[model samples]
Target chain A: MSQTSRPRSRSGNLAAEKLTYAAMLTPALLLLAVFVFIPVALVIYGSLFDFGLTSRDWTFVGLGNYVEAFGDDVFWIALRNNLIIVIGSIVLQVGFGTLLAAVLDRGVRLGRTLMRTIIFAPMVISSVAVGLIWLIILDPNVGPLNAVVKGVGLTPPKLGWLGDPSISIWVVLGIAAWQYTGFMMVLILAGLQAVPKDIYQAAALDGATGLRAFWYITLPSIRNILIVAILITTVGGFKVFDLIFVTTGGGPANSTQVLGTYIYLQAFNIGEMGFANAISVVLLLIAVGLGWLQLKTSRKA
Target chain B: MKVLGTACVVSLAALAIGMPAVAADKATVKFWTLKNPGMAEFAAEAIEAFKEKRPDIEVVYEDFPNEAYKTAIQVALNGSEPPDAFYNWVGEDSARLVREGLVMDVSEYGTEPDGFQSILSDGWLSTLQYDGKQYGVPLEAVSKFFYYNTNFFAEHELKVPDSFDGLLQSCRDIRAIDEDIVPMPLGNSERWKLNHFITMLNERVVGHEAANPDYALEADDATLFTNPRYVEALQKVLDLQEAGCFQDAPNATSPELTRTMFATEASPMIYCGSWCAGIFNGEGFEDFKMFRMPEVKGGDGADGTNFLIVQGYQISAKSKYPEETVAWLSHLVSPEMAVRYAETMGRVPSNPASLDSSDQLTESFKWIAKDVSEITVPINVLDVKLENTVSEAYLDGGVELLNGTLTPEQVMEKVRETALKAKAKLDK
Candidate 1:
């Protein structure tokens, strides 16, 4: 064929290729609409109505749910509890996980795989089971922890760790930290391993050694992974329910009730579907906002 | 490429065609229940009975642990494929269901002349009623009664207290021997557990006497909580706590732990419900006897009264076969079924006529039945929102009061605040 005729043939091929790409994308777009977008839209829709357990008595009271939620003291308490969990998990999980990963990276020679498995074991177990296990371990009268405390001549420990309103949140936070730290450890370890050794050598050449070397070179290298870990941990912390539900039961007197459990109570217990949906909408907004901020900061870095 | 696309479409079509054939065949009835060992056995037998009666029907029983059962059942009901029939706790949970139209009105089944004898006690039937419609069959009766360690009482030469002061004196005498041995092991952890104590005390101390003549438990008036008798009754509970009559770390101790302590004779007195009769018997404790809690001194109508809580079955509104579901519920409350359930579960029957003065009845239960025939008002069934909000406040306030964090008045104030919020919600 002549060169001009060949060009026309290529153009036809390109057009056909574009049509194929569109055909391939259609299924995924349809799935997203069915599963993700539709449910989210429904949640937003439900938030505008007064749905309950038995009755479909939905009425459009504009922003009434949001107003009620803002006025409700329990919602504030739950929100505060969520904040505590988020901060606690970020500090204890990512912070400790990174430290542990760094220590392990320096080469502890004794059964490394076994130790890693042991640390990661809790993460693999279901959250409900983990909560139950901790509940027993923290039992005031029968738990071995109290027995050990007494054995050491401590005044017989009388604190109901999980049942006491003052201390239940801390116990719950500790359980969350315990189960998830290993997960963060694995993530941070992967990030640490990916850092080129040449950078460390360069740091050493500049008289930065040990702790200073880690602060200057190592942290910068794994900044993205840390940010990712924070993002994941933050969302996980905010959404925590199974562990708290099984362990403290949002007692003594709703002391440990977080936003997730509160939303559940409003929907199922009190049968305030509209109020629950409002809480969920707020949660979605918060999650998106925080996630966006994290991504933007990571991109800037 | 055109050939490939056609083949893919043909396979998808074939798979879609085959999907319905693999779908469930039998008329499936989704059933949800709290996981109880005895209840599990009872459920199995009932399922067998149901299947025998209707061979075409199939049941899918979903058992959840008791703690998560309430939330799970609620969530499931909200889902697309909700259960056809399910078990529900009595009081506000059932009331909310009935009010919301999630439960079927079983008045037709209950009010039938051929319905089970005493199929609905006036007391239990009241709980199932919302806006003058019945929703469930009474399955079990539970109430706070005084359970004493017979061995301890005998060893101490103590008789069952006839009056409220006498009961306090008994506690004092018991505490004189061992300070740690609380006469009543009131654990504040599960706040609802304390409600039993509070309700029982209300019956004795207030004796249903209202300062305002219009103060009625069932009335729609907002002045119910303002009764002086209610305040006095709550104060008495706080008094018991102040007297060191309850265990330390009341909120920390589980009901199981408290029962274990009583069973082991660590504590001499425990106020619990008739449902625990099975528990004590299962533990093979021979030295236990129950009695009606003593009346408060100088209270009107304080002669004898006992609080009653009932557990029952309800048909779901979404049931495909409403008639069949109602038939099963009617069978559940029949005299034959009631006797079998009571005998199996070690609980008293809701049917007054079923009490044939049988020797099988525990002595304490028999005595309470004979002397205290009046059924204390059920506070839990008054209003859905009110009950939950008040119960939660009662629990939290009880915990604080027991822990010396709040006074009786403060607790009452907090409860008032909670009640007002609930009332406002209901009004809206």
Candidate 2:
């Protein structure tokens, strides 16, 4: 009788534990299914058809839309611009952010909070606001930057900073870096602060001070945070829209066009929802690939 | 628990019973328009006037920013609660809506005794018609012109250019006055500004006979947009650039900034739409004057052929109050409202009969009104006239053309290639 009772209690506990797990996960899984999975599935499904946003009729085109995107000149230009933005952002935001974060961590002796706040101020401003501010500052005729450039006896870009196709994308990249670099600095700075002073002291005894200590101890300690900073920058870079939309509008002959704006142009402006969907599928695959890479990297870390 | 449940049911029942009665007394006509300066005020006036004319029909008004309005209008039309009557540009965009069956035929309603058709002509009606059916009530037209600073011309002792060649020489003369000055600061950053120039140039150089066919995509692919004069029209724009008519970086400049340049006397001339009259005035620069896009020597455009985009309102097919919405639109475009429209918005009203009666009209507004009345043919703007794909090519080409990155032949080559694709797609 005692052995039978013991088995019964154990079974009851197991059932309760399984119930707890299901109860915790159902709402989250339901939300993910509704918001993420279903939309992604629908997007992929829509890519196989030719349809307008308002048109009820859908013509199945198989892989025709994707093939069209591959052949599209504007599509290639937009994808190239996106890649430029991604790489430029990583180098400018992450590379400079590490420098600034290290300086704020130990180099600067005074106004630490003030410098941090000033550098990070742009991060708090909305991207649209940032774009508007930059637009005014970069105006060809009236912008002070041009005046300053001329005053310094140097000629500005002949087609204006944002007007020249050769240089406009780089200007946009610089503007993006300006907005995001400080945020990266703050993120890395927090990670640096978490690093113990004892490690630095030990490194100093080994004749590893300043740049050498930073290279050995300071960097190795914040390795995971820097990886995260880079990951965030890469994702944010691909997803960039409002800034480019507000500034160049993928213009000066589609020179500044990115994948996000191009997708919008096809879907809303051109009314080619299916083509837009195909582009969105490409973006989604890139995002998934990046996410998987991040996951693998985290596992290695 | 019983008392609370009973109270909740009673409240819901009261709401349900009251809603239909309220809806019965006043059928709502949701109206949408692009948000421009003074447009909201004009729309509010229209709504108020509509209430007086049709007391039973309540007009609900909504407006969106000009850039956002295009997307908003399309999205709203596809949504569950679409506007009953929304403002639309009269061209390919309006035609596409008709093709998609998103808008109503309104032919029968528009032809009724109190409809807009009674006051409007076949030409004005033709602007919004597809397949001989009127789909909209013409509100106003936006015409393009060269707004020259009167003081600048006066100070420099310059005559207003009358021919396209004269215009180029005029740019040279102005630049001669001040080599550092941008004779005409054309901000083509958005690309439409320069496209507007080329649209008028194409009409001037080749006329509607060659363009309309290619524009309509009825021209055979071999000859599609292959007109040598189409390149000549782009060449005319390039000629302007070479004469130093524009800034070194025209492609990067904003249209608004260009407008301000003329308004603030930073630039002496601007090829601007008639709407600039109000803006230049509002910016406290009233000593400016406008002229038609000067004649192109050896061109086919008639003496009075000019840029005029007929913008108006269309009733949604999904509207529950189509008849009432049509009435509301008709009232908005009536002679009395047209006068108020011209006075309030400083636009060229469709019906200018009552414009002289409105003593509130600006001298510039009256001048534009008289000039618009004398127009022989209104060439709809190319960006709005052409189908999306071709228009996009034109816009992008305009940017490249201004940037000096693409020559006239290259620009037209790209445009022709795009037109061929668009024509093929349309043929299918």
TM-score of chain A of 2: 0.96
Model 2 chain B scores worst on lDDT over the 10 consecutive residues at B108-117
For residues A102-181, could you state the per-residue lDDT of candidate 1 as single tens digits? 87775577777787788888999999899878867877767787778778988643547776677789888999999999
To one decimal, what is the Cα RMSD in angstroms of model 1 from the true structure? 5.3
Clashing pairs in 2: none
lDDT of 2 by residue, A112-184 (tens): 9999999999999999999999998998888999999999999988888998889999999999999999999
DockQ scores for all predicted structures: 0.36, 0.77
Report the Cα lDDT for residue A1, model 2: 94
The alpha-carbon deviation from the true structure for residue A172 of candidate 2, after best TM-score superposition, in angstroms, is: 1.1
On TM-score, the candidate that comes out on top is 2
Model 1, position B4, has a per-residue lDDT of: 100
lDDT of 1 at B160: 80
> What ranges in model 2 sit over 4 Å off?
A1-6, A299-301, B1-15, B110-112
